[model samples]
Target: MPVTPDRWNDLERLFGPRGACSGCWCMWYRIKRSEWSSNANAGNRRAFKQIVDSGGTPGLLAYVHDQPSGWVSVAPREDFSSLERSNVLKRVDDKPVWSIVCFFVSKEHRRQGLSQALLEAAVKYAAEHGATLVEGYPVDRLEGKKFSSVEAFPGSVASFRRAGFREAARRSPTRPIMRRRVRPRPKG
Candidate 1:
């Protein structure tokens, strides 16, 4: 399930004063570049608050020791226009897709595989919510190459693979679109 008001403080603490891993506050995929850069701090906070206050959950939050530890932005693909505009990440089909856009883990929570757990939770969330398909655009780095948590916000191919998501298409060598089917069984 997505984060709610009760979980906001945990999120704030998890992200700390920097706001969810380097002042992003998880705003990269939702807003345009100019706007995002300009409103990096205040605007992002306002946007996140608006989503929750309006009874909408932009993504799920992970808690460790009863404290917010991580976050991932997941929702209907169409909800994020910035994605469609990107040359790298665009619609592959007219069929609706639930997209897992970004991931952010608290500094203290890094390297604990929290991302993989959040991803698995997303699969279940989509399944429960009647999503026929869930998709993600994860980075595909060269073999043996490594990326920091921030660099892998979109997630790594290996992470999505662990979540039972398979490659559906690859528009760019470094970007592979991964997907998982969560549809309920059809009536016989």
Candidate 2:
């Protein structure tokens, strides 16, 4: 479900005290390198909390039997500061798009199709929230190589393909910018 204020505790519980990846708190793309380096984990956690507290729906959390099991960061492209600066992920078109920047599945939930589910959920989230295009950066993989958990946060090309996102651009050998057009719900 959308990460609202009431759901903040659920998110915190899912991320744990370490803030999911040694203090990333899912803010790697939201803040600058200087601020991120100086503030680190605590700072990023606070920043993310503030976004939630202020009624910003930064992403969605997936639940398994009512237990928060996964997370996917999906918001407008403009919300990701780091993405705007990356040449490898530069915009492929002038059309506005929502970006999927991160995914975090609990250790127990890994390798169980949670990431693909999250991508589908993200597309629905973006469409319902007024986005017509949803984009993601996924690793296409190298011959006979596997991505460690940390290296796969943005998702895998296979997952994106399974989620119906096609490659829009591939600036790097492994990194492909994938996109899917979303049809918003009809208004009453």
Candidate 3:
């Protein structure tokens, strides 16, 4: 579900003090490279906290029997400044899109399909928030090659495909821009 202030503790617990892999705190795309490098760890933590404190849910969190299990970073494409400046993940079209930028699954929850579930939730959340399209930048794993945890954070192409996203473009052989159209849930 969409993360809120009430769930901050759960997220923090899932990310730990180092902020999920060297203090990224999932701020790699939200801030400039220099800023991210300097603001890593504590600075990134505070930045992410401000977003949650202000009632801005930057993404959705998945739970396994009430315990936070995984996360998928989804927000307006424009929200990720790094993507806009990315030569490999440049805009595919003028269509406004909600971007699914990152994923973090707990060690115990790895390979349990939580990433896919998180992605599904992200698309639904975006649709409800008035997004017509959802976009993702995923790494295409080479045949027979293994992907390390850090190398797969953006997500794998198969995961996006399973979530019903299609390859929209690929500037680099290993990176593909995928997208899926979304329909908002009808109001009761």
> Residue by residue across 18-65, what tens digits does model 2's lDDT show?
898878999998888788878788999999999999989899999999
lDDT of 3 by residue, 4-45 (tens): 999999999999888877899889988899999888699999
C-alpha lDDT (0 to 100) for residue 115 of candidate 2 = 86
Please give the TM-score that candidate 2 achieves against the real structure.
Answer: 0.96
Per candidate, the number of residue pairs that clash is 0, 0, 0
RMSD to native, candidate 1: 2.9
**Candidate 1, residues 1-188: lDDT per residue as tens digits?**
37888777777777777776656787777778888788878778888778887887788988787777888888888778898888778887888889998888877788899999999887777667668999999999878888776679898998999888999888898898899988744322
Give candidate 1's TM-score: 0.91
In model 2, where do residues sit more than 4 Å from their true spots? Answer: 186-188
Cα RMSDs of all predictions? 2.9, 1.4, 1.2
Clashes of 3: 0
The best candidate in terms of lDDT: 2
Error of 1 at 182 (Å): 0.6
For lDDT, candidate 1 versus 2, the one ahead is 2
